[model samples]
Target: MAGCGFDDLPLTRPGPPLNAWGLYGEGDEYGRLNLITAQTVQAGLREAKEGITINLNLPLDTMPLNPTRAPLRHEIIHRTHCNDDHVSFNTQGSTQWDGFRHYPYLNYPEKQQYIYYGGMTSDEARDRSNHRCGIQNYAKKPISGRAHLLDIASFLERHQRSPLSYFDASTPIDLETLESCAAESRVVFKPGDILIVRTGWTEAFFGISEEERQSLPHRQKRGSCGVSSDPEVLRWHWENGIAAVASDAVAYEAYPSVNSPSIHETFLAGWGMPIGELFDLRELAAECKRLKRWTFFFTSMPLYVNGGIASPPNAQAVL
Candidate 1:
């Protein structure tokens, strides 16, 4: 069939790829749901063989204070915990999806695309009972695929430099900067792979003096980086066909939008791809850099809470 009268057919064709990214596919345009099992997911973790679990557990202790811009008071009910026993569980914080509901696109400042598949509405998407892109999808089974870690820290280190020791509130991640980092790291990216960035910014804030750290421009806004976000950089990530993105930086992207626009529009709203903000990728990045290898058995399991807006994943980078 390949050589036979294929030339007779029109040059143009309309169809999805053998492995397309969106909700549907070619043969089964309305893709079938893949039920991930606990055993299968465990197998993925075992394949990683690192025996290391990067705790993506949300700092419940700090969460309550985050809303008030102060430390959490012990008197307040700890929503994420159940009991005082260290091992004894009392009550657990109701994990959320941090759905498109969690953030707004700074640039367009509009709602994420309301995609309805199989007669579902955008409002319904948030309904946990409906299971529309619930966090469960992230953990019902292991996410098995190619993963690439872009070591922003190593990239700068190779050039005898580094990102600021602290969030500068002025640092911005642009396309050129990302490309330059990739070139230095000698990393070649592939489509549909998870893209991870290592900024090393979160580390600086962890133990810094509250006054100096809080005074930083980005922190003054939201305890984020000093650099602003850029649209072109996001366009690059989307154009490259990245399935998802994770960053070591606290805010994933920059803090304040220099151009008054953020890439969240392009990646989250426009593409419907998820973002793993506040990922702890230091060791992972360091390991890849030292090994001079990138491909790995990557997996992350997000909490399976219904109607959840965000999830604290058990994200892992295994080689």
Candidate 2:
């Protein structure tokens, strides 16, 4: 395939896989790396003036799953006597992000890496007590920034096109349709900006009966379909210097891709991007449409566990 000029194809080769944070791409011409040393909670707090800060967290129990696939557990002791004078009921669970010690790819740790600064394993990393970027990373951060919402569902609705009752789990995304949605929205992106997308899938999940949701598999091998994002769009985000990308879908990239899930591979492995998935953008989308402003403060706190693989972001938008 390299002989076919395929070497230049971004997704053709194996790169780093997605971690708890996001993809980290290859080095650049000037030896610069993708998504290296992003702004941490300390940095964010230094910039905030103050206003009404809205929380984007949807209580863990309210979240679709009991616990994300991340490695962690909680023990509940119904009856436990600490000393008889006081009976102590104990419950233990890992809150926020999964440390690098939580997961090891190819049996390796993220020691000296971005999130994992000191060591790799939990023991080596000092019992995973570090909170470098943990939920605290978002503390004191300003929720006041330029935010834009791309409502793909409304774009489809205007054309009288409706997503499948249960989006075709096997269909590849239509790139053209995605471009059309952007055009219809009259949205413009700037460098170092935050981007948000709405697909209305989150609502569908909520609307379904509990029994129905329980009956469905966690994720289907054949994925959902719609205007899937193309490489050019992904490149646009990078070239335009987009700081972050948020989506209300299960996975940001379109399912059943024609290009081998290039978005995930590139963003996670190649660029070290920070993705906000399973975000609650409905309120923000509605406000953007109502005001026709399409801009606001986009903020989120990712799990800051060192060497962690993934974390549920406490995302929010302040308009």
lDDT: which candidate is best? 1
Instruction: Estimate, for each residue in 1-319, the C-alpha lDDT of model 1 and write its tens digit.
Output: 1121212221112211111223343221111122123443354344455544344334544332133333323443354755343321111221122333344333221334443222234667565576554545455533445567776666666678645444545465557668887776666664555667777765665667777644543343453442235545654664564656677565566754455335443344333456666665667766776677655656666666654556665666666
Q: After superposition, how far is residue 25 of candidate 2 from its true place, in Å?
A: 12
Candidate 2 segments whose C-alpha is farther than 4 A from its true place: 1-55, 63-145, 164-173, 218-222, 226-229, 256-258
TM-score of 2: 0.61
**Candidate 2 colliding pairs, count:** 23
Q: What is the C-alpha lDDT of each candidate?
A: 0.49, 0.46
TM-score of 1: 0.64
Compared with the true structure, what per-residue lDDT tens digits does model 2 show for residues 161-200?
8563334463333556655666766656544466666777
How do the predictions measure up, each by TM-score?
0.64, 0.61
- RMSD to native for every prediction? 8.2, 8.7
